[model samples]
Target: MKKVGTMLGNIAMYFGVFYALLYLLRSTYNFEVTLSFAKFLSRNQAMFMAVLFTLITLVYLLIFRIKGWIWPHADNNLFRVAGFRRLSAPRVWLMVGMGLAGSLFSIGLIVIDDIAQLFPSVPALVDDLIKGDSAVYVIMGAGILGPTFEELLFRGLLFRELRKVMPVYVALVLQAAAYAYFQPSMALSVISIGSGIIYGSLYLRTRSLWAPILVQITAMSTIFLLKYAGFYAWYDKLNEGVLYFITAVCLMALIGGSIYVWRTSDQGHDWIRVAKARMADTPSAAPKGG
Candidate 1:
């Protein structure tokens, strides 16, 4: 039933975003201009949908910004997840380094995918999309706003909600798989799932959303900037020798970072315990006095 509710929430979120786009289309643009823009985007259907999706999702995020906070705390009057919680600057920076390490790991997956021809090329698709006037829209829409909203939904809501009824590990795995499966290609799926785990682990450790949000923005904005600047061509031209070395470096970083996260943090020890405590505790009850 909890899963069902989550499914509904996911559906409603997308629908809300879609409706906002429809409303904007009807109100913000005259029919003739709208027709012309549609025709223009029709030149690249993939980018048209991507831009439209991002804009709609951004509008949805703006509308429910307050409500989004409310849900995290809805578990108890004490939402330690993000709203009322924060990490120290030093701790946040530690996670930043770890998350970037993970980002390198994800990028390495793409590089390998390119070599193996394992999936459709996202860079090529973005190249098709990021032309002329749409560049700014794609950058802001897909690069920045899109990722923030995903974290809001996946990290902020779904993971916390799952923590209520299930074990922390269970919630993490399920959420990670869902995140990966929703992405465009198998290669990206692998990368997304890997990122989802890192993000989920960070949230659990710090009980703060900002850490993962920062990491996501860093990874996504870098990729978007690269695409915008036509840097993927240089990436494409890189010899297999360089690709192998970078992939090995990324793998080592990922392994080392995961070790650091596990051994150096109490979050791993607290993972299941925290969920159990929160799950057993109820909103109607008073928060325990420390």
Candidate 2:
């Protein structure tokens, strides 16, 4: 169908163009430019790439916006927090909380695997991306830049477009699949797809990119920091009893948070405000309002 082809083509183009631009910038900084630039890049590959890629992606997004590309506007309702805000606020805190909870949930899956070995080990590429990278680079890339671009494209633009034609759940699956496809390894791909489902659902309910962005940033940063701090190493050394207990606690938090959101989301916009709005919309409450 034309719809499927358009979606796939859009995915391919986004990645293709992004990588092409990144490669071009990197190649220029490495070879086409001065020797000092090349040395700097060679020395701080990951961090430098994150900064550059994030910068370029932002610029590309700007250009697309100016040109009226097939994308959602960042100034719209979904992007109220587009530019990181100056004031420390409650919504920001909420995003951090949701992000932390979501991260714990996803990593719980891996901890479960460590105990059971039911899943295959992470792919070599995924392992390299995870364990081999230095702290500064990993934190910048995975924590900040990665979350920014990914949320912008997937939940911000792509999902918006898909929802126009298909059901929200269907769009969530399609975008999740797209998200998974871009990951390094099969294991990560699977995990990302699962995570995408949760994130997409949250986005649908919350209508704010910040919620999922925070979740993503926290998830990635926590995983990287834990790996750096040897938490996983310590986890591996734990006996089955402790492992099971930790795993269960994480599962509970994950599932509990998910259920709370599902049951209490009140049609998905501004949780603090949703409750009053929900009550006001009920027939009895409507009569009271009159």
Model 2 regions lying over 4 Å from their true place: 1-13, 29-45, 68-95, 101-134, 267-290
What's every prediction's RMSD, in angstroms?
A: 5.4, 7.8
Residue lDDT tens for model 1, 1-290: 76457546754765566667756754534577578776566554434555665676456455445555766543232233333256788766775676465444445545555544665554454455455366666656555666666676677766766666677788889879878877777777876787788777766666667767776766666666765576555765677678778767866765566556556668435555667765664653213200
TM-score of 1: 0.70
Clashes of 2: 2
- lDDT over C-alpha atoms for residue 65 of model 2: 61
CA displacement after TM-score superposition, residue 162 of candidate 2 (Å): 0.8
Worst 10 residues of 2 by lDDT: 281-290
User: Which residue pairs collide in model 2, if any?
Assistant: 99-215, 205-268
CA lDDT scores, all candidates in order = 0.61, 0.60
User: Which lDDT tens digits does candidate 2 get at residues 1-290?
Assistant: 66456556655665676777777666755554466665655565456557666765666566556534443432222233222223235545655666666555544555655623554444232244454236777678766787777887777656655654465567779989988987766777876887788777666665566667777787678776776777766766767667677656765654565556566556434543432432333333221110
What is the lDDT for 25 in model 1?
52
